[model samples]
Structures are given as C-alpha cells and as structure tokens.
Target: MLLDELVVTADAVASTRSRLAKVDALAELLRRLEPDEIAPAIGFLVGKPRQGRVGVGWRSVGAAMGQPADAATVTVAELDAMLDRLAATSGAGSAGGRSHELRELTARATEREQGFIARVLLGEMRTGALEGVLTDAIARAADRPGPVVRRAATLSGDLGETARLALTATEAELEAVGLVVGRPVLPMLAATASSAAAALETTGEASVEYKLDGARIQAHRVGDDVRIFTRNLADVTHRLPEVVEVVRGLPVHDVILDGETLSLDEDGVPRPFQETMSRFGADAARATLLHPWFFDVLHVDGRDLLDEPLATRLAELERIAAAYRIPGEVTTDPEVAERVSREALAAGQEGVVVKAIGSTYAAGRRGSSWIKVKPVHTYDLVVLACEWGSGRRTGWLSNLHLGALDPTGEFGEPGGYVMVGKTFKGLTDALLKWQTEYFPQIEQRRTENTVWVEPTTVVEIAIDGVQASTRYPGGIALRFARVKRYRDDKRPEEADTIQTLRGLLRM
Candidate 1:
C-alpha cells in the first residue's frame, strides 16, 4: 500500500472525536493492507514504530527535511525497510549515515507523507487511533469477535502479530494464542480510589496488598533459566541478576510471577524510586541490590493461573514464593482494610491495592476488580512544555506545563494531551538542571521563554484536587500541583486522563 494512503487514514482518524468513526476509518485502512504491511502500517498509525527508537531526534528530522515529491510513491514496505536501515545505523560515522538515509527516505515522500514521517520519527503522532480503538478496528476488518482478537493480542503481547493472525489465519489458530512461559504478557492495571474503605467497597472480600513505590517486574522462570521484564515488556534479565537468582530459587520448575523490585536502605526501608531505576538502566549491576516482592503468580509448573481467581493465584504464590510475597491481608471488613493501608504507609510504602478475591486476572485492563488507594492524590501526567526559570534559578527549565491524556478527545484532540496546569514546585536543583539539558533534546518547537516538547515524559504529580476552570482547555485545572517524581517506567499513553481529572471535581 502507498504510504500516503495510510497517512490519509491517520489524518481521518485524528480529525474526529467519535471513536466509532475513527475505528471505522482505521478498519477500512486495515482491510486494504497486505499481510506483510499490516504491522508496519499499524505502527505508523499508533506512533510507535516497530523498529523502536531509530536514533532519530527532532533535530535529525529537521536537518533531513527537503523538497517533497510531487506525488506519493513510497510504499509501506519501503518505509519499513528504511526504518530498519535507520535502526541499524550505529558506529563511528553512523550519525551521518542515518542522516543520509532519513534524507533519502524523506526525499521520496510527498508533502503530507513527509509530515507523517516526521511525526512518526518524533513519536508525536496525535491521531486518535489508540491501541484499544485499533484493536477493535482489527476485529472489524477481520470479521472476528472483538473478545477473541483482544484475548489473542493480550496473551501474545503483540498487537501486530494478533492483527496478522486475525486477518490471515483461521479463528482456531488465533484462539490458540496462549500465554507462553517465556514471553511476557501485559501486566494487569488498577483503578484509583480515595481510601481503603472506598476501594473495599469496589472490591469485596479483597486482598489488600501494600502498593510499593517500586518498578514493576514480571519474571518468567523455566528451571534454572529465568528472564525478567519491565512493565513495558522490555527484557532486563542481565541488569537484574539478583531478581533472576531469586526467581531461580523458587520451588517450582516453571513459573510466571508479577511483582515489584526496589532497593532498600539499611533500615529495610525502600530507597527512592530513582535510585532503584538507576539499577535497571545501568550497563552493570549496581552495588545496591533490588529485592523482588512477588504479589501474584500467573503460571506454575504448566498450569495457567491467569484464568484462576485471585484467591487461587494467591494460594499458588504462597506455596511457591511465600518468602518473597508482598505483605497483605485477606479481609472484607472496611476497618481491616484501613488498618492495612495505615500499616503500608507506616512502612514507607505507597498505599494499598484492594484486589477482589474472586476476580480473575484481567491483563492490560484497569477494571474495578483492583483499586489502588493512596492517602494523597497523585497522578502520572505528561510534560507538554517547559519554561525558562528566572531570578536565582535563571537559565534553567523550571516551570513545567503539564497535560493529561485525552484518548477519546472528550475535551480536546483525540489521542492528544489536555493541558491541566503548570508547576515549578517540588523540583530540586538537580531536577532543574536535568530538565534544562534534556528538554532541548526532545524539543518540538520553542518560544522565547517556553520549549514545547513532545508529550512523552511521564511525571508523577501530587495535587490537592482539581477544580472547574476556563484557564485551560480541559475545563479543569490542577489545584496545588507539584512534581512528586519522574516516572521513567511509564509511557505518555499511560498517563492519567482528562476525564479522570474531571472526575475529581465530583469529589
């Protein structure tokens, strides 16, 4: 298929607020793609290239811009091949080689295609075709059941492959996609609650586990060989050898465990989140050790526990990894839930996650079966822009323009962010220095005082609450917003939504 065709579809998807219309437009596009073109096309549509980061930044993209082709001639396969070459370019002179390749690739594209390529390279595609909507589109195009496609995608952890199977293979073949021991599945997500009692009301007879402020990890072990993956499914087995050893020591021969890992100080208190993340990003393991705390077991000795109730999974987790299980209690009483929350906070943990005992694991979905309650209101929001600091903090990027996700475009552009508020508070000198150096690297555009960046940085912000306001496009502004920390583990799409902030008005 021509690249322009896909660009046109993406434009169509972005120009509307109705999810059905977006899905229909994407489904129409999907129906026209060849089997081999499906994955790359999907990647471009969602702003996540299959090649991942191709070492191309905004400046690189800008440097490569030239006169566009008069007509569209670039094919999807050709674009995919170009991305492959760009990803492979690395060495002493790789920068020049990448620049040459990008220029050549862009030179072959029409004006609209050039813009599409730029957005895709910058990871700033603002189209409304989120994964869920595109998944529905895949189902629509393939004439398959939505649940079947969704299950296959969730289990396989590859939406592109799921689309391929749903469109080209038989339904039975698609249904055969099961949870593999080695492949990491998407982690289960949770909703937010104000307090333990509120969370308990949503999840009756729950397992209230400590919500640790740590990086999420999923470990898969087959005998002595164990693999560790981050919540984003990036394998970090080599970086987290201690975690591998812990999983290897488990009683079971084969298992899949979901948990968190954090470095602890001498007092057994968890270290700052950044300290723990530093270990994950290092070339060699740091001196600080990260202790793995398993909360749920998904697979054990060949039995798939994902379909099993939390009670069953907890039983399996206790039997196999009791020593590493996170502290929690099984109770229906609101008072007991509150006590657990208090205990967790006193232990320097985040709060408590109340999980329904009878609920099965719903991978990649934030259902009411699990609710996280924190004493303070905090949200993961995106950094939309940064402004220059003044006075004593001059020459640094101090004030952050924060935005919340608007996946459905209820308040703004679909699949874009809605600016909620700005903050220069809670940032240490080190953070300010880092921002000054980093924001320029991803800078999309700039004014005299503000640097508008791609909405890709996820920062945890603590807020008193939100109130109705016309100062922002979302009809609400954050009250007393301050940065808690930078969540390097999360993606822009994972940030909390505008609708979520608006919901706080009701409180």
Candidate 2:
C-alpha cells in the first residue's frame, strides 16, 4: 500500500474525538493491507516503526531533511525494510552510513510522507489510538473477540506479531499462543484506593499482601536458564547475577514468577524508591543487592495458572516459593485489612495490595480485581503555568506546572512559588475547557507552547509522597502527583509551604 494512504488514515484518526470512529477507520484501513504488510501497516497506524527505537534521535532526522518527491512512491514494505537497515547500522562508520541511508529514504518521499516518516521515527505519532485502540481495531478487522486478541497480544508481548496472526490465522491458532516459559508476559496491574477497608469492600475475603517500594520483575525459569524481565519487558538477566542464582535455587524446574526486588538497609528495612530505581537500572557496581519477594506464580511445571483463580495460584506460589513470599494474611474483615496496611507502613514498606481471592489475573489491563491501598498526602498548591494539549485534548491547556509556596523567598521573592513538577493527569475534558477559558484571565505571559499565569490559583493536589531531587529549588518533588480539585476557597498565602513538602521527604 502507498505510504500516503496510511498517513491520510492516521491524520483522519487524529482528527476525531470519538474512539468508536477511530476504531472503525483503523479497521477499514487494516482490511486493505496485504498479509505481508499487516505488521508494518499496524505499526505505522499506531505511531511506531516496526523496528522499535532504532537509535534515531531528532538530530539525525533533522539533518536528513531534503526536497520532497513530487509523487507518492514509497511502499509500506519498502519503508519497513529501510527502518530494518537503519536499526542494524551501528559502530565505526555507522553514523555516516545511517545518515546516508536516512537521506536516501527521506528523499524518495513527498512532503507529507517525509513528515509522517519523521513522526513515526521520532515516536510522536500523536493519534489518540495507541496499543489499546489498535488492538480493538485488529480484533474488529479479524472478526475475533477483543478479549481473545488482547490476551494473545499481552501474552505474546508483541502486538504487531499478534495483529499479523489475528488477520491471517484462525481463532484456534490465536488461542494457542499461551504463556511460554521464556517469554515475558505483561504483568497484571492494580488500581489505587485510599485505604485498605475501602479496597477490601471491593473484593471481599481478599488476600492483602505487603506492597513494597521496589522495581517490578517477572522471572521466567526453564531449569538452569533463568531470564528476568522488567515492567516494560526489558530483559535484565545479565545485570543481576544474584537474582538469577536465587531463581536457580527454587525447587521448581520451570516457573514464571511475578514479584518485586529491592535493596535493603543494614537494618533490613526497605530503601527509598529512588534508591531502589537508581540501582535497578544502574551498572552492576554497587555492593548492595536487591532481594526478591514473590507474590504470584503464573506458571508452574508446564501448567499455565494464568486462567486459574488467585486463590489457586497463591496456594501454588506458597507451596513452591514459601521462603521468598511477600508477608501478608488472607482476611474478610476490613479492620484486619486496615491493620495489615498499618503494619506494612510501620515496617517501612509502601502499603498493602488487596486482591480478590477468586479473581484470575488480567494481564494487560489495570483491572479492578486488585487494589493498591496507600496513604495519600493532599495539599493546596499554586499553578505556575499551563501548556497546550494534544491528541483528544488538542485545543485545551492540558499540562499544569505545579509549584509550592516559598514563604521566605528562599527560592523566589517573598511568598512566591517554586516549580516542583508538571502533570497532565486527572484532567477531564470539562476541566480542560474551564482551564482554557479561565487561566488566561490570570495570564502573566504567553509562550508558543505554554501560557504563564499568576501564582494566585490554588489547586488541591494528591501525592503518593515526596522524593529528594535537585531539579527543583525546594530540593524535592512530588511523586505520582495528580490534581484532586481546584481550591477556589483558598488564597496563595494559605497554600502549603515548600517546607511542608520537604518535610514529607523525612517521613
């Protein structure tokens, strides 16, 4: 298929606000693709190249721009081949070689195709439809159930390949894509709640496990050969030999374990999340090592337990990895759940995860079967500025630059605010419209991308906690911060102080 056809379809997809419309358009586009073009076409439609993150930064794309072709000449297969070559080029003369190849690829296309190729390479194809929407489109095009395709994609860890199969293979073939012992399946996620009692109310007689402030890991073991994958499915088997050794010591021959790993202090207390993350992604040079805590087992000895209930899986997990299991108790009482949560907090852990005892694992999506309960700190902070939105939030001011009041002019003037971080989360379309209409009235200045506003608007923000950082003048930033609401009743002087946020760091 012509590259222009795909570009036009993407532009149309981005132009609409309705998800159903986007799915229909993408489904129609999918039906037009040949069997060989399915993967690359789906990749382009979802704003990514088949060759993922091919080391092509904005500098390389910016340097390769030239006169556009007068006509549409590039095909989806040809573009995929070009990207394959670009991804394979590395070391020594790789830079010059990549530049020449990129220029040749770009020079073959017209202005529209060049822009689309740049967007795809840069990973900025901002059509509202990402993996979720495209998965739905694939299912609709293939005449298969959405859940079937979603589950297959989640287990396979490759949506492009899943899409190819869904379009070409039978439903039985798609169902046969089960959990392989070596490949990493998408880890199940949890929804957040304010307290354990509320979480337990959602899932009665639940198993509440200690939620550790650590990196998520999914370990796949086939006898002595063990592979560890991070949350995003990046293999880090070579980074932590101790982790591999621990998995090798397990009694089971083949198992897929879902768990967390964190470094501990001398007192055996869990370290801060920042410290854990730093070492988690760092080179293997540190003396401190991370300890694994298993919570769920997805597979055991060639038996796939993903379709099994949580209670069944937990029994198997306790039977196989009892020594490394996370500490918790199964309970139906809300008070017991609350007590477990308090105990987890008192032990320097993050909180507790309340899970439905009978619920099976929903791998890809953040289903409501599992709830994460943690203490939240809310404070009235000032809005420093706002930035233009994109995708569905196109014309509205979406991202808010949040700041805490510096009472003594330590960072700014007396009673001024210092920026902590930016967040576009927890904003609805109605709120976007309100910000677009109201924020400009307090406008201090305007940039091409942002609208600076006076530090008079007080907004209530809920945060997981504070982390020590050098990026902000207050020496800390809010973690997992989201807008609770706009505090119209409060003044800038009455807002929470930077000292209050910094104090949270000590806690």
Candidate 3:
C-alpha cells in the first residue's frame, strides 16, 4: 500500500477523541493492509519504524528536509526497507551517509508524508490510539474476542507480529501463542489504590506483597541457560549475571519468574532507588550486586501457569522458589493486610501490592486484579515557563516547567525558585488555551519552542513522591508529577519549599 494511505489513516486516528472512532479508523486501516504490509503498517501507525530508532534524531530529520513530490508513490515496504538500510549504516562518516540517505528518502515524500515520517521518527504520533487501542482495533478487524487478542499480543510482547497474525492466521493459531521457557513475556502490571484497606476491600482475599521501588525483571530459564528482560521486554542478560546466577540456583529445570531486582547495602537493606537504577543501568563490570526478589511464577517445570489463578501460581512459586519470594501474607482480613503494609513501609520499602487471589495474570495491562497502595504528596508549585504543543495540542502551551520556591538564595536569587521537573498532564483543551493566553501576559522571555514567564503562577501539583536526583539544582525531583489545578487562592510566597519536598526522600 502507498505510504500516503497510512499517513492519512494516522491523521484520521489523531483527529478524533472518541475511542470507538479511533478503533474503527484503525480497524479499517488494518483491513486494507496486504499480508506483507501488515507488520510495517502497524509499526508506522504506532509512530515507530520497523528498524527501531534508526539513529535518526530531530536534527537529522530536520536537516534532511526537501521539496515534496506531487503524488503518492512510496510504498510502505519501500519505506521499511529504506529504514532498515539507515539502521545498518555505521562506522566513521556514517552520520553523513545516513543524512544523505534520509534526504533522498525525504525528497521523494510529499509535504504531508514528510511530516508523517518526521512524527514517526520523533516518536510523537500523538494519535489517541496506542497499543491498547490498536489491540481492540485488531480484534475488530479479525472478528476475534478482545481478550483473546490482548492475551496473545501480551504474551507475544509484539503488537506488530500480533497484527500480522490477526490479519493472516486463524483464531486457533493465535490462541496457540503461549508462554515460552526462554522467551520473555510481558510482565503483569498493577493499578494504584488510595490505601491498602481499600484495595483489600476490592479484592477480598488478596495477597499483599511488598512492592519494591526497584527495576522490574522477568527471568526466563531453561535448564542451565537463563535470560532476563526488563518490563519493556529488552534483554539485559549480560548486565544481570548475578540475577541469572540466582535463578540458576533455583531447583526448577525450566521456569519463568516475574520479580524485582535492586541493589542492597551490606546489611541486606535495600539502597535508595536511584542508587539501584545507577547500578542497574551499568554494564556487568559494576561492583554493586543486584539482588532479585521473586513474586510470581508464570511457568514452572513443564507447567504453564499464566491461565492459572493467582493463588495457584503463588503456591507453585512457594514450592519452587520460596526463599526468593518477596515478603507478604495471604488473607481476607484488612487489618492483617494493613499490618503487612505498615511493616513493609517501616522496613524502608516503597509500599504493598494488594492482589486478587482468583484473578489470572493479565500481562502487559493494568487491571483491577492487582492494586498498589503508595503514599501521594501534593504541593503548591510555580510554573516557570511553558513549551509550545504539538499534534492535537498544537497552538497551545502544553508542557509546563515546574519549580519549587527556594527561600535561601542557595541555588538562585534569595527568593527565586528552582525547577523540579516539567509536566503536560491533566490539561484539558480549555486549560491549554488558558495557559497559552495567560502565560504570555507575564512573559519574562521567549524562545522558539518555549515562553518564559514570571514564576508567580502557583499551581497545585500531585506526585507519587519526591526522590533524590542530580538532574535539578534542588538535588531532588518529583516522581509522576501532574498538575491538579491552578492555585488561585495561593501566592508564590506560600508555595511549598524545596526543603519540604526533599523530606519525602526519608519516607
């Protein structure tokens, strides 16, 4: 199919806010794709290239711009092959070579096609439909059940391949996709709850396990061979030799274990999350050892437990790898769940995960079956500036640079503020318009993409919490920060301090 066809479909998908409309548009596109075009079409629609991050950045694409062609001529297969060649370009002078190839490719595309290719390369499709929407769209196109498509896609961990199968293969073939011993399946996820008691009330008899603030790992072992994958399914077997060694020590001959891994100090106490990440991101030469804490077993021996209930899976986990299991209890009593949560928090862990006992593993999706209870912190913060938006948010100020009032002139002027992080969440179209209009009235300066304003607009911000960081001048950063609303009743002088935000590090 013509690349322009996919571009127009992506535009149609982005132009709607209705989920049904997006799914319908995507399903229509999927139905039109030829069998050979299915995988590349899926990737382009999701704003990714078949080759994956082909060393092309904004600067490379921006520099490659040229006059557009008058007609749609490039095929999706042609573009995918071009990207494969670009991804393979390397060695000295490869940058120039890649740029030449990109310019040649961009020269062949129309202006609209050029924009679409840029968006795909920059990872800014901004379409309402992501993998979740596409999953539903695949089901619609295939006339299969949504849960079946979701399960197959999640277990396979590749929506491109899932789309291919949904378009070409029979339902029985799709259902045959199951957990492999040495191939990583997407790890199951959890939804957040306000409190442990509330979560237990939702799940009734639940398994309240300690939720560690560490990197997620999915270990797949077959006999003496082991492979470890991150939540995104990227293999990191070399960086996690210690984790592989631990899994090798387990009694199981073949297994798939989902768990968390973190660096610990000499006392066996978990280190700060940032410290754990620093070690986790390093190569195998790092001295700090990462310890694994197993929580769920998806496959053990010759048995596949993904379709099994959580209670049965936990029993299998206990029988095979009890010593590696995270500390927790199983009960219907809320008070007992609360005690376990408190003990976990007191022991310097993040929080507790309350899981439904009878729910089957819903891999790669956050559902009600598992709920995580973590403390939330709210603060009145200042908006220092705002960046121009894109796609649906075009012509509006979207990303807000957030700051905390720094009373002591240690980082800046005596009363000046220090930036903690930036956020574009929780903004409706009306809010975006208001910010675009109001922020310029207090403008301090301007850049091509951002408008700097006086740090006087106080807004209430909610965050999972704060953590130690070297990125900001305040030595801390907010985790999952989102604006609740503008605090018109409060002034900048009354905004929360950096010191106050830093106190959350202790918790």
User: How well is each residue in 1-507 modelled by candidate 2, as lDDT tens digits?
Assistant: 988888888888887978899999999989899998998887877666668877788999999989999999899888899889989998999989888988998999999899889988998888777888899999999999998999999999878889999999999999989889999988899998889999998998899999998999999999999999998788888877788889999999999999999989899998878888887887666777889999999999989999899999999998988989999999999999999999999998889999999999888788779999888889999999999987567789989999998889987788889898888888877889999999999999999999999989998998989888889888888899898899989998999999888888766
lDDT of 1 by residue, 363-432 (tens): 8778999999876799999999999975346688999999999999887789999999999989998999
Best lDDT goes to which candidate? 1
TM-score of each: 0.77, 0.92, 0.95
lDDT comparing candidate 1 with the true structure? 0.91
**How does model 1 score by TM-score?**
0.77
* Best prediction by TM-score: 3
Worst 10 residues of 1 by lDDT: 389-398
Candidate 2 has an lDDT of 0.89
Please give the CA lDDT of all the candidate structures.
Answer: 0.91, 0.89, 0.89
